[model samples]
Target: MPCDQDKLAIDDSRWQVAVAREAVIRPLINAGQLSPIDVATACRILGLRRSRLYALIEQYRSAPVTSSLAAARPGPKKGARRLAVEVEAAIEEAIRDKYLTRQKASVSTLHDHIRHLCRERGLDIPSWKAVRARVEQIDRFKLVRQREGNKAARDRLRPVPEEYRADHALQIVQIDHTRVDLFVVDTIYRLPIQRPWLTLAIDVASRIVVGFYLSLEAPSSASVALAIHHAVMPKAEWLLARGIELDWPVSGLPDIIHVDNAREFRARALARGAAEYGISLLHRPVATPHYGGHIERLIGTMMGAVHMLPGTTFSSISERGDYDPERHAVMTIEELERWLTLEIVGRYHNEVHSSLQMPPNAAWREALDRRRAPFRHPHDDQQFFYDFLPFEERSIRRDGVHIFGLRYWDDVLSPWAGRLDRQLRVKYDPRDLSCVFVEGPDGAHWPIRYADLRRPRITLGEHRLAQAALRQRGVRLTDEQLIFDTVEAQRELLETSASITKSARRQVARRARSLNAADQGAAAEVVAPGTKDEPETLPVLAVEEWS
Candidate 1:
């Protein structure tokens, strides 16, 4: 098969004929039973024998794409080296040292260089056509990057098509984050807090929402990780936990995750985790918004649904005139999440997608029917969740491994204590400081708890707030006890004032959600590794009113 089955050269007449053949046979295959007359008609149309026609039908059934029927090319097979080893090496050297440089040398110059080198080695000179073919074989992005520069390559070599294509389910999934267009209230106060951010993943082939993460906090690496974790793992248990009965069967490690060039999307944690799970990450060009058109459309569709809810902001001031979202806000963040889940699995999946021309669920099923093998899923659920989390390297001492002013100790750390040769990698969920995972030498992550077992589990946000409070009181230096005490005091204050103060209520609500996340073993509370306490400002989106 070709490396890129979806793309075919414009002048590839054989592939074009195969594509036409596929179109003629597709309906007959769909009908399942082929009569003698149908078979004879298909054989006549395709200029093939009965046996060859049956074989083509089987091939098409296994992979219902035009490329599946592509005939083997004449001459040297793909990736075959026809020239002598020394001559090929000379040609490669010439291309690398001369052609692929900022000097912008032409193919003729490269061919001449290759000829001269072949003569120097007393080898036969290859044709200019072979040299040009080798040059064309070099990746376009790499070629442009070497010859022009990174910026030019990025700007000039993006896909020109308006719609991103995927041949099967889980082939290419797009993940993106957007602030929901509704104001959700605090669970206790029943008063509006703020719009929550939603990190969503959509399968490009079927337009099915594979997974998503909703939070009151802004989008971060943690959001991306959580979203991906949800995307890759089965949703049966998750749906049952949420009391949702709808079947959301879409779950698998996507072949490629397409994303925009946001910092969270580009985080080292995400890149490393993707590599660990055998998933490819494709970042769209810097200024190419259309490259992300599929996800953007999905987001828009979701927001359009949101506009029907009680506390909807209506997407623009003009549309929201004379209406206050806060006064009408009814659902809490958790409630909003549940509502979105119902909206997705119950309605969106069943409803017809404009692009797919069929319901997403149906498209998913059809794609699955075409596949010879099942989609890939993570084997270890817990480890998959931990892999995408931001990590820190900490040295283990006699007492424990110290991080964020807290010490974590477990029997597992005993073996690696006091080792100056290397620091162990510790992965923690920012939502819970009760435990951290210390990676052992054998690549297994050991869960290490706080040295003081009695210390209550607190979120990174709460910890940061307490630290700020301590600094305000002129406590320049502090200990674990001091930090926990400050956190407890702050929580007490927030609880006490929650009924009267909106800000206090918001904080209390956020804390409750954080504790819930920690209980579910969900790591990340919008804090990326190596980032400070303050959150980055979200980019302002232009108004995209519903048509």
Candidate 2:
């Protein structure tokens, strides 16, 4: 009808000022002290519309008006959009849909789910604060607890544990595995076999590597078994065996062994065996890496050391160039292991740690001053060894303990042998099949040798490979042919592995590296800048502030 009200009225501030000005002028106009033209002149001076002033003059005659006027920080009625009752509902739905499932439903992830729902429904989106507020309405502790269980809930929802008292070394140890970025050679041929995988354990408080194991073989439960054994058992004998003359001093059952959820780390043997010695196993929340940063850094540092070696595959392809990691590779697997050992005790442990400002060994020594608790050790080393080995339960037979079609016998088993009721647990190392240990009723480990004493020693892995190869070739392996096939299979494997190119070997190493339990990629933040088509720097802050 009339000029649109919004256009006819001045902005809210001027409108208020105009009303106030009219309020004071109206008395003069009513008193005949001033006329409409005089008020119009004042309205123009105040940048208030003359028409709005006239309109307000009429309202003032009828009702009261005030000077207080400014646009309320604009948004929705009653303030910023109350997270559309639907948006709040969406947030709860997203939390249930994402957090309640297996995927790590981090706060950001929950927010993303809500945003996606808002987009799909064509609803007005809210600020991140609004989304976060909705999320806060849910019981965070209960959410984490329900999804990940007790330990995880505490870690996620609560502050870092002050009770840990890191003044003592080995209070908590974090363990993980990495693939060395170097090609390793065979003992005889001196050809690159593969980039070896390394299992490492660090004393969390000390930032020192307490134990490590390196092998050409990929990580397995066996690898974890070896790493734990190395971590707990004294290193003096091992060092002496390797001819490494240095003090390792960092071995004992740790108070807590923090690890990630890998098959190796989650192995039943590891859990039970550790508990038997008062050590508890802890797995970090999935997709959280900073929890195990110390060991992850150690793995990175160790790999950096390997990268300096002659046959290094390097971290990425761009780092490799035309240089051949294989042809230039000179260290045998044993030699590499020795180098790693020497580097650990001789260099890393003794060198000053960047964070601690003291050598790890020195830190270990100082922590000992505050260590009031007696050092815990496994009561039986042999039993400890048996505990970690994979096992099968079977009653002793007329011959002996038969596993995977191989009969293993020992004089100790003779007492229980031929007794169908006597169910003995047989534990064997996957790396060595020469013998198996039969657990007695009293938990004694009886060494059961292969019945054919003339047969040479072979590992379970080799045996499996041989059996598989034999089957593939339409051949059957009798007990007499078992050793021969095993040896042949092993030789074939080594030769075949040795012939792989550096790039292929690097790929294998990379795959293993990606499998690291530390979630190596979790901490990285990815940002993509605009290209030539877009401005390099958008002066968002300055422009917004100026406006």
Candidate 3:
């Protein structure tokens, strides 16, 4: 019945009583009164009683009706008006000067410029949002004309062209400089700090870091050359002491040295070095990195290890002073060096490669075993870098050495390059054979006379000599053989180790579980069920109320 109220009201809307009640209510309200007759008529029209109508009106009146006929009022504080005078001035200046006209400048760029201007004037700049608001107030419909062209085309792909090898081992050693973030000790300051430098190296068959140079700056041709020397050199002194005497250069003279387009790699010194070693040098494309993928991967591996070192920061060694044992880990430089050579390198060589399926050392040894007898690592290419690469020592002149037209006079380099040709060693990277590095007596090496630095190119013929010396005692391999063997070895090692370790873990877990179950069962038998360990009971208190 209650739900039928709307239906009853609708039905009453068609009755004559409803029309009469609607017409009579206006006059009664004009008289500022509601008569019984009017109330009765309204009740009948609306399908309710007179008392109910009066009660409903009172109830609704007390139910809080909001005033709908009120005048509009302003909202809460609309916030302080921003100062756009400076922004307007800047925009006008930009427009007048043609620095920017029809094209709209980004809010961020505007903010940055405004901030820079404020900094120059020693004035505080407003927040970025305020700056943006000002810009919007001035010209919200501004359009920025963007230059259209292939950005990818601007950066040509320069990949190190891969050289074809016929066999495994040292067939084609790829060399590249990877900028690694690392902490180096500033010997002068005796503090630990972070520094980035060029890590140059050759990736032998097993992707081992056969040779590398860690410097505080981008590597020079000489640094690259030194890395090559290390690559060809015998195992580190510590490794040799530990009795790891196996013929190296096992694969052979790298028939081709692959490198990126860095000036060091293209230097004459490096080219001469490679030529002397009977190794052809190849340069990568302008921007493509995948051409020399192995060396790139090796760089990643090296940096990964570097990241694991503690207290590493992003700074230069010269700025922070020599690595402080107190600040860094408690390892001395010699100790750290030893660890790197013996532990890191040793582990790396011995670890089974995911791609090669064999340890680098194993692959190297196998290549050696397959080589021409006497099992001696070849010396044929050892002198290639060592002899042909030029080392010059130059002091920092009042005017720095003009390398490719740029003046590089770092305070650190100033101490070394101040003098004229003060006997610095300059070695070139073989890949490009156009750039040479100035090597200092303090073992600091960097690219010398880079094209950007405006250094004149020395003639290659001056350094060119016959590849007279063949490696009398090392294994030689074709490029193809090297890659196949190395890859096969890595794959084999990864799959084999995974399988063996997984099975061994499963067996050990199963055995341990069985032993645990048996022990539990035996222990259970010795324990008696339903032992008489009675629960403690509390005494009940008798309550008495005495009058």
Better of 2 and 3 by lDDT: 2
State each model's CA lDDT, in order. 0.79, 0.66, 0.45
lDDT string for model 1 (384-411, tens) is 7776887787778988899999888866
lDDT of 2: 0.66
Q: Give the C-alpha miss distance for residue 283 in model 2, angstroms.
A: 0.8
Off by over 4 Å in 2: 1-165, 474-547
Residue pairs with clashing backbones, model 2: none
Q: What are the TM-scores, per candidate, against the unseen true structure? A: 0.68, 0.61, 0.38
Ranking by TM-score: 1, 2, 3
Q: Which candidate number maximizes lDDT?
A: 1
Task: Give candidate 3 misplaced runs (Cα > 4 Å).
Answer: 1-166, 187-190, 196-200, 236-252, 313-335, 369-386, 391-547
Write the residue-wise lDDT of candidate 2 on 1-547 in tens digits: 0111221113434445544454454454345455766776767665667776566555544422221222233443322234567776777787778866667667777777777899999877667777665556556667677677878887776545433335687788888999888877654455665777889998877877777877656788877877887888888877897788898887777878888878788776676566444466788766777777888889888888888999999989998888899788888666887899988889998889998899988888888776766565655554555667667878788777778778877666777788646456677666556556676765455666677665655555556666776788777745646645656655555556644554434333332333331121111111111212222223323223553
After the best TM-score superposition of candidate 1, give how far the Cα of residue 260 lies from its true spot, in angstroms: 1.0
